[model samples]
Target: MSAALIVLILLAVLAIVVVSMTVKIVPQARSGIVERFGKYRTTLSAGLNIVVPFIDKVRYVIDLREQVVSFPPQPVITEDNLVVSIDTVIYFQVTDPVAATYEIANYIQAIEQLTMTTLRNITGGMTLEHALTSRDQINSGLRGELDSATGKWGIRVNRVELKGIDPPPSIIDAMEQQMRAERNKRAAILTAEGERQSAILTAEGDKQSAILTAEGQRQAQILTAQADRQAQILRSQGEAQAIQTVFQAIHDGNPDQKLLSYQYLQMLPKIAEGDNATTWIIPAELTKALGTLGGTIGSIPVDGGGSKTRVDYDASIEDDVAADTAATNEAVQEALDAAKAAENPATTAADLPSQEEPPPPPPAGGTPQA
Candidate 1:
């Protein structure tokens, strides 16, 4: 019983070692390459895999999933002889684990070196400005070359990207200054254009204002002239109506020559009232006007029972003048009496000189003697 128990324990120990060596637990999305006597063989996939325990061995483990590799910056010379430091990132995936494990000694290093060499070659054809601006083209070129070169090695380059490209500090400063100058120039041009537009608008506004003012003035003048003309027309109409009314009143009343002469005499004072008058010539027909006035007054109908006696200026004036003249220096006295009567009728009548009364008593005696 003791010998059997020891044998069972030894067999269990051997089984544990054999199991540990024969089975491999491969993680998900991973591949293990197997080698027989240091020679190429098959690849192990994910999950539990079995291999010949002594002669067959898992040489290398490769991740079938995509991987990322970042390369340090490398200095490259451009066509313009400008040195620029460029860093790159490569995305690759293992398609065949056998080739990824055995085809290349170090696939990561190889890819990185290839990336650097490819970047140098591509950038060597372009100036610094072009290299900085044309990053997509450089990336595409590198990816294409790398994908083709790694195809046999069971590596697929999914993408090649330039992480950064840094120019010299002096070049960066010069570019910044150039950009600022360009911006200033554009700003100045825009400012000038704005000012020009503003000036043109102001001038247009002023011109329009002036034209409108002139038009308004013209309209105002026309209106004023029309108003003045209307006023003149109204004044003339009023004057004409006044003259017609006066003429109609005179015709309707049929005033006599005495009334007409009185009105004419009243008008004479008004004509001489102003200092601007130069001449006051009496009418040539004054004699005819006086005769007409006398006739009109003598023919006037008396109202009530008033006597219709006519004035005889010739007899009264002749007798009085002859008598006064015979008594006191005949011719001289007659001239004096005529002058007094012509000057003022009331004063002359009261101042008539008394003649001798013997003529009245001798009148009867002379008739008997005769």
Candidate 2:
């Protein structure tokens, strides 16, 4: 081949090689860090781009999207000198690809070691209980420290979380017991409160019942008193009606002294029959009643429809005296028999006063001449 033809062929091959080496296509959410002579030159964004063939080279490819990094468990000492194992997860994203490539070597490994050391340091200042309970505080603290430190490395730490914290077996057992005890205590307190409420409700119910019963009794008493008052009013009205009827009957009859004496004598027996009767006093007008009765008997006609013959008043008085004496004797005998039955058997007739006196001897002519 001619020398010119060989030169043209070599030029064509070189051009093709250069073009192939210079062309670069970055993927979505990614960036390429370019370097010249082992020094960072520029960063390439997503899309097609070109670089000086031999001078510029892609040194690092970085992902700009958020990522998760989980670290293995690391042993840490707490404030109480207890060793615990802790694992963590971190969320981060690369903001600047050039800085991420040049600022730090092995950024993921560096961050993991730093996180382990920082976690140990923080946990060293806290007891096991605080370390277990303060996960959010520790995570926030670790995230702040990581974010500040990784700013130059083009890494932004979004969040940090403690995946787990494992304590010693003895501590785990002790915590379980403590939890059980707390649950039991809460249960006991609840039971006691329930019983107290039940007792209070029962007492309240009993009190209400008692109050209602008392009110019912009071109402019943009031009703009984009203009934008694009404009954007494009716009884008084009935007695008044009876007395008015008796008075009207007597007025209608226009009874004489004889009728009056007869009615009084009839009432004496009824009065004596009552259990409350102790003694009865004879009226001072009893002798006048007898004389009136004798006068009425003398005025009474002997023959039916015959003009009244002149009656001897003194004879009638004598006859009345004898009749009264006989009636008194009989009444006294009856009263004596009743008194003997009511009294002790030792009582005799001699204890009583004489009811009859012997009438004055009749006049010698036997005409009841006075």
Candidate 3:
């Protein structure tokens, strides 16, 4: 009975061990490679999988999901012989578990090494500037080459990216300086353009202002000239009216010697008021004119005078006015001539007569006044 109990316990323990080895549980998105006698047999999928406990062994467990690997910065020489450090990130996936297990010993290491070589080759053909700016082109080239080569190892390169490209410190500083210079150049050009436009606008404004000012001045001159011309015309018209009125009064009223002498005396102050008058010339008929004025001064007919006396006085006054008109005109003309001669030294004294000839022979039976 003891031997049977011991045998049963041993058998049960062996069964548990067998069950633990045979039933394999793989997590999601994971694949297990089965090798029988150190040879690849088949790949195991996720969840419960059955295998011969002693004969079958799990050689490798590969994730079927896409994986990302970031590599350290590698120094690469560009076409211009500049050493640049570049870091890369690679995305890969295991498509065939069998090939991945049997083909490459370590797919991750192999992918990383291949990525380094491919990146060097791509960057080697370009300058540092080209390499820095052409990250996308370099990534595409790297991905294509890696996908094609790693496809045989049951690894598909989904993507390749350049995480960072660090140039030499000196080269970075130079590039920064160049960028600053370019910005400064653009700023200077913009500033110059602005100044030029401002100058043009200012000049145009000044030109407009000058033109307007000149036009205003010209118009003012024209208005001034028109006013002067109008004033001159009015003055001439007034002089003509004055002369016409004087001629009419003389013809109708027949002024006497007293009136003629008084008119001559009134004109004396006006003749002396000229701006150019330097010397005064007395007319030769001054004494005769004054004598005629004195004689007629008290003889003016009064209202109480007799009608015969009044008629006789009126007749005498008419005779005297008609007879002295020529002498008065001559005297006035001499005064004007003297004023004109004083203004211009070119006038000869013979061109002016101081007095007229003695009045015509008295009418028949009329006395010739002294």
**Leading candidate by TM-score:** 1
- Model 3 C-alpha lDDT per residue in residues 275-366, reported as the tens digit of each score: 98877988688877677654443232111211110112122222343344543454345335434545564544244321233234445555
Off by over 4 Å in 3: 1-9, 180-191, 215-261, 269-370
lDDT of 2: 0.75
> Model 2 compared with the native: what TM-score?
0.67
lDDT score, residue 169, model 2? 98
- After superposition on all CA atoms, how large is the RMSD of candidate 1? 21.6
User: lDDT (CA) for every model shown?
Assistant: 0.74, 0.75, 0.75
- For candidate 3, the TM-score is 0.64
Q: Between prediction 1 and prediction 3, which has the larger lDDT?
A: 3
Q: Give Cα distance to truth, residue 261, candidate 2, Å.
A: 5.7
* lDDT per residue (tens digit) for residues 223-256 in model 2: 9998897665555444434443443344344445
Q: Estimate each model's TM-score.
A: 0.70, 0.67, 0.64
Candidate 3 yields a Cα-based lDDT of 0.75
Could you tally the backbone clashes for each prediction? 1, 0, 0
lDDT of 1 by residue, 1-370 (tens): 6999999999999999888879988999998888899997888888998887888888888888899999999999999999999999999998988887768999999998888888899999999999989999999999999999999999999998999999999999999999999999999999999999999999999999999999999999999998887665555444434443443354345455577677767888999887988778875898687676545442332112111122222432333433433433433343344345445524431233222211122233232110
